[model samples]
Target: MEISGIGSFLRNRRFGNYLEASFGVNFASPSKVAVKEEVEKKIQSVAFVEDDGIGAVLISWVRIVVCFVTMMFTTFIWALIMLVLFPWPYQRIRQGNIYGHLTGRLLMWILGNPIKIEGSECADEKVIYICNHASPIDIFLIMWLTPTGTVGVAKKEIIWYPLFGQLYFLANHLRIDRSNPSAAIQSMKEAAHTILKNNLSLIIFPEGTRSKSGRLLPFKKGFVHVALQTRRPIVPVVFTGTHRAWRKGSLHVRPAPLNVKYLPPIRTDDWTADKIEDYVKMVHDVYVKNLPESQRPMH
Candidate 1:
């Protein structure tokens, strides 16, 4: 079978360049296909030889080590400094938003990458902020930008992820266990109570997981339920360039500018469950459109 031009471009030009080949004579007779068989054997042997496997594993290991060390040192050093220099209340303030912002700035600068924040004018002191999930670094950026206390709605697994786990508990975080659907819903109900009682803002990723392709994943309705129950405002946040800057499969911090944009808040005062899905889709589309051309997810 012959491949089309586009197929040729995608296969041979894009990825087939790494394949092995057999260089020998080809006979004109029907029974003499030695070169073809030799080539097939070579192809099979080379096909399973992963060119990027070792490099990927080593890089992933290095990233884990670096991330662990950075999270530990930053949390410890900042907490210690805040404890020594401020009163109890002031210390809590520093530890929460201030320290987080400082940590993010330090990480970005040290990585020689800058994050630009725009559309902050739409940010309210108290509201539910929803953004596309892209990476663990999403936590730091959201906390840094939020003035009023921001509580993240994260998965239960995060409660066990190293320094992040301890900090999450310390910050009075909300955990949703998706494995048990009922339990997850109950957790969100409890979180709604906390949000209302404390007049605190919640940051949730409706997508539930980070996008490997950078495209907005299908959103879960748990966020809508919580928003409706609390009758709080919903602010849409778009995080651009985060995936390229720190992709899920790799650990090396590539230098790139990350952009965070805050859209106007949407209220649940008159929204119905039926239209919630439509509303969420619209917000996602808006985010996709507003994203910089270079950072927009390829469909």
Candidate 2:
């Protein structure tokens, strides 16, 4: 699409209203009432539950054991394959993405959560993806929805996570040290370069960390710089219900509806370093306004 078209679309309030209506939320615009009602009926058909009990606790532990075993077995097998293909880094990384994707899907299936993905048609374009962080499963959710060449930008600490860390490294996902300003800057540069060099879409949680309150957190500015530096359009993705499925600091996984929406990409051709805050706020508002009120950040 032309840059002008993108600009016009982004500025179009009606489209934003339409998105809100699609999520079963009331929009200030009167024209969206019909759409809003339709979405509400659909949403009502799918039950949303929040349970914490003895059975829930037992189920959660079983899921953890099963998922852990599955991950370890799969990661070890992938590790062996990686060793054999170590001489061919590109092929190794490709295999790692495939392995990660398959393993993630398996885990989701085992968890028995019904996933409803929207705007998957946006996957055709390669762009920088900025998503809300709410659970550890956010990475897997994105991997399952996006194309094969997508990589994630994670914190440096994730490199020490057991089997998952090894797989993350083998997948060639970029990791940065949040504590070291200089290192973090370098990682951002590397992320931009990696996207251009590998022709892969990069996923970054601008929030920097998961939300403990299930509300959107203030975004970090590093991703803004990454988008401007790479000159790639920014695709705002929202993963609702993941926190309900697996809340932060919880070991149990609930069988909840998982929603993934890929919103339109905003062109970054005219973006500059000086407008970083404005850019961040624009995207942040898109998430805050679109999400259900219960999922939005508390004022």
Top lDDT model: 2
Q: Output candidate 2 Cα RMSD.
A: 8.7
lDDT of each prediction vs. the true structure? 0.64, 0.75
Candidates in order, TM-scores: namely 0.69, 0.82
Sliding window of 10 residues with minimal summed lDDT for model 2: 3-12
Number of the predicted model whose TM-score against the real structure is largest? 2
What C-alpha lDDT does candidate 2 achieve relative to the native structure? 0.75
True-vs-predicted CA distance for residue 15, candidate 2, Å? 28
Per-residue accuracy of model 2 over 42-107 as CA lDDT, tens digit each: 655677677789898898889889988988998999888888887876566566666766677667
